[model samples]
Target: MATSPAAPRAASGGPVRLSAAPADVAALIMHEADLLDERALEAWLALFTRDALYWVPADHGDSDPLRRISLFYDDRSIMEDRVWRLGHPKMFSQNPPARQVRVLSAPMVEASGADTMSVRTKFVMFEHRLREQRTFGGVYLHELVRQQQEWMIRRKVVHLVNRDTVLWNIGVPI
Candidate 1:
């Protein structure tokens, strides 16, 4: 990828510095959601570090993407291809692509460091197409890094409340 190299992951065992005011981190997340709702996949992709992950687990509280089934477990390349395919004119599921709207709550700082922060937020998204509208709710956990005064997502783990339910062609991102 032509994006900036991935910033090193903050050691999980390190002393985490939680921020009292994580508004900036929260704003970046909302902006990304806006980009997705606008179907600006490429621009949305740019908000991530080169080695970022976009994951959605199948089990209610699953943490291991490698050990179990998942709704999505996309690395940079897979994410890129997914965005490309979603925008392709020949994609039937998106023939008349659903319109998506996301409402994200204020972010709660979960963990932080000098260069990394994890924010958790609740989201309710509605995908509308034709005469149908499907509602999706979840918790969005983002691990973001500070690079040159910019906050970029290193990992986005979404735990959907309806993870086990049968969903339609989730052609659009949550």
Candidate 2:
């Protein structure tokens, strides 16, 4: 996994370089999508760092994740709860599990700071079940950290093009 030459110094007068392999980063995100599509919520949650945040903003570039309303804003505890409910027999939605397929485009590595790197990518997911099919397309913004030769998501922010539109339900991860 060879990296390109060091990026030009930042305007703030600091050297910027990415320590993680691009392919590795790409694979990590791809695997995450696969896990979600496969309904492996527990495995998917494990890929996040302890302090990780998962957010789907209701508005594009909403700035403040907390103050601004979001479709889904979850921490580790919340994610665990979601997984638990998803796995429970009482969870009516799972009586007929949703079928899903996700396609993630090649990741574009952005700014690098210390152990963290920002990534931007596009994705399209098709979810079908009970004779209904819903397609979702959006841009994903991820803050990733290199830990012991593996890249883990520190924060994930999804920006959907039609975020404000009323939807039937977004029960599953997008």
Candidate 3:
């Protein structure tokens, strides 16, 4: 069956313009990846805004952020705690740090609002120990904002392709 095209909706507001360049956005993303790969937790956390949120959703189709539990849902305070724990001598998990390598690719601009942009990117991360290398591949949805001539993360939502597996602790930031 053939269908006729619908008419375009009337403009409720003026067209939006993006002030940041694509190259700059890509550079910021690359820097973030580098920071994680280098295990620079403090520096990595600094890239987030004061009201930033870091989340790893528990299910693929789960959209209610308030009711559903998450793999991780951290604000600045929680993020600070995590950073402190990672470097604290009392943290047994840090005795032998889990080595990790993350590769972020195919970043595409998904949406753009007034002061925020939503980006989706594919990633492959390998967390390795003596003889085991656990690999995770998924897409990351980032809500970023421009602040003081720099782009900082407002929210980072990681969606792992596999949601039903019992996994080891993710001591390090994904």
Candidate 4:
């Protein structure tokens, strides 16, 4: 892919114009949700850039992932392992794979640059397995970067509302 020149910024250090339209941004977010819900792990992994980071903070107040304990923090290598585990038929945890449905609010673009955008969205996910149902709600913070013509996730932070509390099995990706 041909690299585009860096976008100009305003005096306040913000992008003067967004690289993607709001609708496009929302569509990407929705597509990601669908991929996860459908258990299309490989396709979902393709949405992320090679160096992407996926994080779920253990505490709402936690900042630095390296210094603070996180519920889940994964880079490309870790993500690949996770994908493999989730897809493996012998993985007992997923023997009777959980059924999940995610509902997301409108994604709001918080910042934009020549090739990057930051988005925030609220979501609630319901998972059912082994005759038990679980609900999780939180915000998704995505840092997306345009690679050629497609937007890829550079970082995704999942802030669970009940992060600090002990939770049941989260066998599937959130």
Candidate 5:
């Protein structure tokens, strides 16, 4: 969608120098995390673009979500399905449900254009379910697009620092 003059501009907003702490973009990112932690999947999905991707690579620094084994490589349709399953009473993995606490730091702007920006941030996620807790630490790289006058995530790639290790089947969305 064409950006309206009233739209909240990102780092590339004219002569202003981009800072790591781009307030507007950072707020969206944090809000996304909060939605997930609250298990508000439907609300969380609204933060993405229609063709968005939620990817978790099997190996650190891997970009090929399709070619490699991944915890998740969901597109829009898949995301919706996952969200449905998460709320389904019959979904076994969620027997006890999962609780999560995620901390995201100021994102480093990797690339920025008029309608797109790539930002990377460090994340430490604590997920607990079924009497067990797992701490997942990694870098979250997000590619956001300007759509309908908002910054929507086009692609969110998560590279777990311990991706090389076995996951034991994490029952929760990271």
Candidate 6:
């Protein structure tokens, strides 16, 4: 996608200069959700950089994933292992393969640098498995870097609305 040197309103309601347009940013985000919805785990993993970090903080206020307990704090290697396990035929947790659909709001460019951009988007994901349905809603904070002709995720933080509560099995990537 081509990017324009325009500023867009950030999630905090302030304008930030960015090399990417809101539409371009939203397109990347929507594509990621679509990949997950299609269960294209390998393709989804390809959206991140080699040193990517995926985090889901246990609490909304918690910072520093290293010092705080997180629902998930996975680096690229861990993500690779997870992708393998999720695809393994004998992975009991994914025996039936949970179905997921994610709805995301338009992405807002919160900040940007020469080769990187920070974005925030609200999301709601619905998962169905074992005859049960669960809904997860949250805000997603993404640090994206321009790689070649595409944007690759460097860090992704999922701030779940129910972060403080005990959650059911989230066998698949969120």
The candidate scoring highest on lDDT is: 4
- For all candidates in order, the CA lDDT equals 0.80, 0.79, 0.75, 0.83, 0.79, 0.82
Name model 6 segments beyond 4 Å from true.
1-21
User: Which portions of model 1 miss their true places by more than 4 Å?
Assistant: 1-21
What is the Cα-based TM-score of model 4?
0.86
Q: State the displacement of the C-alpha of residue 26, model 2, in Å, after optimal TM-score superposition.
A: 0.6
lDDT of 2 by residue, 1-174 (tens): 111222336679796543444788888888999999999999999899999888887876576767978898999888888899998988897669899998987877767667788887778888898998888888877889988877899888887876777766687778
User: For model 3, what is the error of residue 157's alpha carbon versus the real structure, in angstroms, after optimal superposition?
Assistant: 0.2
Tens digit of per-residue lDDT, candidate 5, span 86-151: 899998778778889999988767678888998777899998887898888887778999887789
Instruction: State the lDDT of candidate 6 residue by residue for 44-130, as single tens digits.
Output: 999999999998878767778899888889999999999999999999987899889999977877777788888877799998889
Number of residue pairs clashing in candidate 5, backbone atoms closer than 3 angstroms, sequence gap of 3 or more or interchain: 0
| Candidate 1 accuracy as lDDT | 0.80
Task: Indicate the residue-level lDDT of 155 in model 2.
Answer: 87
lDDT of 6 at 29: 86
Worst-scoring 10-residue span by lDDT in model 4: 1-10
Alpha carbon deviation, residue 165, candidate 6 (Å): 2.4
Deviation in Å, model 3, residue 86 alpha carbon: 0.6
Clash list (residue pairs), candidate 3? none
**Model 4 off-target regions past 4 Å?**
1-21
